[model samples]
Target: MPSYALLRRRRSGSRATADHATADRTADHTAGAGPRRRLRGLAYLALGLPVGLLALVVLGALTAPVLMACARPADISSWADAARRAALLTFGILLTVGVAPLAAAPLAALERHRLRVLASAPTEPTAPEPRPHAVRFRARYTTARAWREVAAGYLVAVAGPGLVLLAATWAVLCPIWLAAPLVVARSSGGPVALGIGHARSVPDALPYCAAGLAAGVLGIVVLITLVRAQAALSRTLVEPRPDPLATRLVEVTRSRSRLADGFAAERRRIERDLHDGAQQQLLGLTLQLGLARMDLPADSAAGQAVARAHDQAKTLMADLRELIRGIHPQVLTDRGLGAALYELAEFCPLPVAADIDLPHRPPQAVETAAYFAAAEALANALRHSAADNIRLTARVRHDRLTVDVEDDGRGGARLADGTGLTGLADRVAVVDGTIRVSSPPGGPTLVRVTIPCPPHPQEDDR
Candidate 1:
């Protein structure tokens, strides 16, 4: 039994040792794979270096002749020669500047393809707007994007290959040269050296060979880093920058609109809670007063008190209902903007003529903005305007809801005025809307608000 147990212990120890060896091999493989893959990617750029250089050469060839022709003597011997000279200068200028876009089409396309496919960049070149071919050609020449590519191409073509060649030579050739001396000494049993001095034996050659190998490995790493840097620069120079102010403005507007919607939702929630909870309690009180009155004599003080209590509860309940409506109307949610506006007009003390025409409900933010704007305008009219008649009109056209509130009153409503028009303007703007108040001094004041909605929603590129 003791011998058997000893054998079992040995087997377990051997298995654990084998597992550890396997893990060590895996770790080494993982570490080396990263550098190997990086080097492989670097090779792709090295191969591309020649193509870039060749493109630069082609561009130079196309542009150089034109330059030379332009520089040729303008004061020719004959009128015919002068005409020819003028034509040549024009051709050269046209080829370099005017037709440069056309000349660069193939190179730009190739660059875009390389970026998208090989380098895995979303560097898709914007297609020229479709028009007459001549028009398109002219546009391409003028386009900054196309011109930038030409500039980048010229830079890469001239310098890219030269850099790649130097890196490749350092990374590949030096190591081979260093190792050759050692290999020769080992094979032939003779002296060899990689030029620092003659190595008489393999031991003499070892240091030089090892130095070369280390340098080659380092060079490979450097080459990969350079390739990566070049790609980054290329991408930076090519991509167009979005307008900072415009993008931020859009983002801010959207954010504000979101806040406005949230505020409206919260208001609705509070309105519902009050309507459901408090209103029911008030109704129950009114009912209890009625029940208490029925059980008592009609002329009794308690009966009279009960009657007054019932009336007061009913009046209070009505006031609370109106308050809830002001907060966030249930009519607005159930019957849409038209019904809501109509209900608002009915409550106003002044004669309000409402003309609300809409096919569908707009976005919540837009609807809320429009509703509050109309309400504010009416309030302003009641406070300031001496007019008895107010006309409120809402119409939806061209994917926008326009609300107009006109009051005949002594008018001088400015954004400078602290009469809440400025706040209304800001609220309207949150949903990418506009508010225009034509309230000149001494006459009819009209507040018109236009809010965007539907078919064409606001873009959130920011």
Candidate 2:
């Protein structure tokens, strides 16, 4: 260990060293960075055209071999010929639509850095949300950015670069040829031929050099034009388009339909389980308890208990049966919506008259939607509408089922009053159905529901 003073001295020396290094870095950054940045900018401009040209070259190389094979069908076996024809057609479409877009993705991702450093344009990117594989794949081709990028690729990677390459070659070579007279003037005793024509003397070099100078100038102008054009094209094409609300509405509608289908299937499953499994077990238990009661003395406490247990089991079984029917009724599946509506009307608190006429049963989905809508309507009328009499009328025609529920009840029934009308409406909408409630402040309420019914499965099979 050193003395405290020595340690302090060592620490000061280290601090000085670090400070000097930091200052040097700052100086370098302030002075040297500008030219470094300028050269980098120039380098970017210089190589941008070539980069685009190279992309075109790569696209050609990648696609050419397959394309050549596709061109001649007779050279390959018949199956292979057919397969390659299909593949070639697919490739042609991919190329026309989005092969360029796929190619541009990498460049677009990195181009921001190049633009900020060289072109002086910068844009922030939005964060991407995770999506299912199918959705992501669809977006790759369908997005406007991808399509615009496709357009940009054709101009930047193919057309712009091609012109730039040709002009660049002439620009570089012609200027050197402008100095050709010096060498030619001494080398040959006779006239030497150049592009413009023969040069007999040193004075003859004027036209040659002037022509070369003009060509070089033109080439420079073209290259500059191409660079600016490419940058602008990229900016325009790589941005996304604004989506409309109608599109979102369609998606929401599809999602609701899927959910409704899933819910209906689940209800059916629950009904099947309760009816076939639990309810049967309870019924067996009830029968066994009745037999036990018969074997015991009537006045005994044990006998009384057994009798009571049997009655309770029977009641539980009956309730389970009702619950299962409520979930998904066997009567609806067997006898159709018309019969189901009649059965529901029979159970209503208020007297109901039903007029249900149909040539044949509709599709299961349509029947289910109509049955539930009618059930909800009847319930709503009895509980809130204070209805004494209800009329349930249904008719199937023109590939549709229309049901009308009319009640002579208290004047007002609004969906806003939380009468479950909106829920029923949504259920109807899932099957491409419509519901209308016409209820004014006075007395009668008419709820009309219409559902599309596709051709019956038997009709479809025929």
lDDT of 2 by residue, 247-302 (tens): 79889988988888789888988888888899889988998998999999989999
On residues 1-462, what C-alpha lDDT tens digit does candidate 1 reach at each position? 999999999999999999999999999999987776665566557656766776777777667756666664745679898777778777776667755556566665555454443342345566644699887666676767678867766656765776677776685657665686547666666555454466667667777777787777787677667777776666655555465897898888778777887887789889889989998888888888889989988899988988888888889989998889879888887767788899889999999999998887776667777888898889889998787799999999988899999998888887768798999888888777898888888869999989887854333211
TM-score of 2: 0.48
Number of the predicted model whose TM-score against the real structure is largest: 1
Q: How many residue pairs clash in each candidate?
A: 0, 1
Colliding residue pairs in candidate 2: 411-442
lDDT of 1 at 62: 65
The Cα error of candidate 2 at residue 101, in Å, is 32
* After superposition, candidate 1 runs with Cα above 4 Å error: 1-113, 116-154, 157-225, 240-255, 291-299, 456-462
TM-score of each: 0.63, 0.48
True-structure RMSD for candidate 2: 18.8
